[model samples]
Target: MSVQNRTPSWPGEQLCNSCFYTAMRTHGVCPRCGHDGVLPGRANRTDPKPVCLTCASIPEDYRCRTCAAEGQIYRGGRCARCALRDDLTALIVDGAADPATMSTIVEILCGVERPESILTWKRSPKVRSLLSSLSSGEIPLSHDGLDAVSQRTQEVSHLRSLFEHHGLLPHRDEYLARFESWLTAKLDTIAQPAIRAPVEQFATWHHLRRLRGNSTPGHASERSMLSAKQQVTASDRDDQIPHLAARHPPSHRS
Candidate 1:
């Protein structure tokens, strides 16, 4: 989580060195100084209990104001986890145009094992933009609707997974669907009718046909779809099309 704006983890919490060690340190009523705070070390060799850091000649206080929990203070004396929950809840309620539509996201985000990690993700510009689109109904809360927002592929895929996991969206072959959309857009980019026509025919009759045939009841494997897409994309290239024509040249027989 950023000091300015807490967000996602690549794999774990992005805590600073101090905060990490401090969080792991013991905190309780000090036996020596009788002060309720972070425990430092024994006052003497024979001491039976731990003492406050100050009594042991070390001094630092990291306590939550609201919960009295000992940890890294996030904001207004609250711990990072607590602050994360509050922030996420506020964002969901305030940003969502329709609270009912966003209920699943809110529930999942709030109940994460590490709110700090999610907070880090929320701080991302792409994530914020996606959330804005979702909140304003710019992107409909459906699989096909999400398919239309194609640019942010990674973020969209993550959101799709979350929605599917929570039963908000029905599971489908996301890779196949993405390839179909990509093919349409890719074909549209070809201005030459000759090139476009041949490319479209090849994509539809060759790659897509085989892919559809191979797909089982559940979603097709990502590897299979990726291979098909690569072949179709390769065929769309100017040089590759000439080769395609050479291999499958039109026959004129008597």
Candidate 2:
């Protein structure tokens, strides 16, 4: 039997997105297809339309912010903050940074008021050992680890004060230029393989934004630098060693 498609005449009933069937039942999977129901489209309806947690709007294209995977949009882009936090934790576990340092970084990023205490705690010898491991390439980097770097550096007391004084507004052009130059230097010194992916991802996201006209020339330049850095690093690898021209012919290789 064909299902009847009818418009509801009741005061509070509304139609579903998939099917035109109207009902007063506000909750539960659809009776016909067992799929989730769309929110009722009514002015007085109290139920809010499902929205992403981070951006607070229904995601047009659902994609996880962390893993960049599909089918994980229910929790607002895969819990961006949690994913970031976990990544940082992994970096700490791998000895990228001392636990104290990591804690200080987290406190700053999470907007903790007592950042001084955490910073002091991170200055211990035990914490210094972990940081040494990170410096010596004994431990790998992670996405969260890179985020911690960004957050910690951005939160320098003086810089934070300056930002607050400037109304906490984003100086996109200025920041873009500085970030580009800074990252170029970092790529030369950074040896951790695990952190590279996230750093590149961060750069790409900025590049896309700049391309879309949401950013400025400085931003574009910064992205260009980052892209170039990634290419240079890849070319320098033994597996994909770059071709070098010889001044003399092959016969000279006696």
Pick the lDDT winner. 1
Model 2 lDDT per residue over 1-254, tens place:
11222333324453452433222123344333444533223323474443221222222333457755432122435533334345445545345435654555443433433332334434466444544554344533332333334433533323333333344334345444445555556655757554443344434443434433555522445555456456545543444321311222233331
Each model's total of backbone clashes: 6, 0
Native-to-model Cα distance after best TM-score fit, residue 130 in candidate 1, in Å: 1.8
Give the distance in Å from residue 29's predicted Cα in candidate 2 to where it truly belongs: 24
In the range 1-254, model 1's lDDT, one tens digit per residue, is 43322321212235455554443366798776578876645576677466665676533345677677765566766776667667655666576789776655776775666556677888888887877788778888888788778634888888888788778888777667767778888898889876776677777777777676776533656897788778777776778877666554444111
Candidate 1 stretches with Cα past 4 Å from truth are 1-73, 192-195, 216-220, 234-254
The TM-score, computed over Cα atoms with residue i paired to residue i, of candidate 1 is 0.62
Worst 10 residues of 2 by lDDT: 241-250
Query: What overall lDDT goes with each candidate model?
Result: 0.68, 0.40
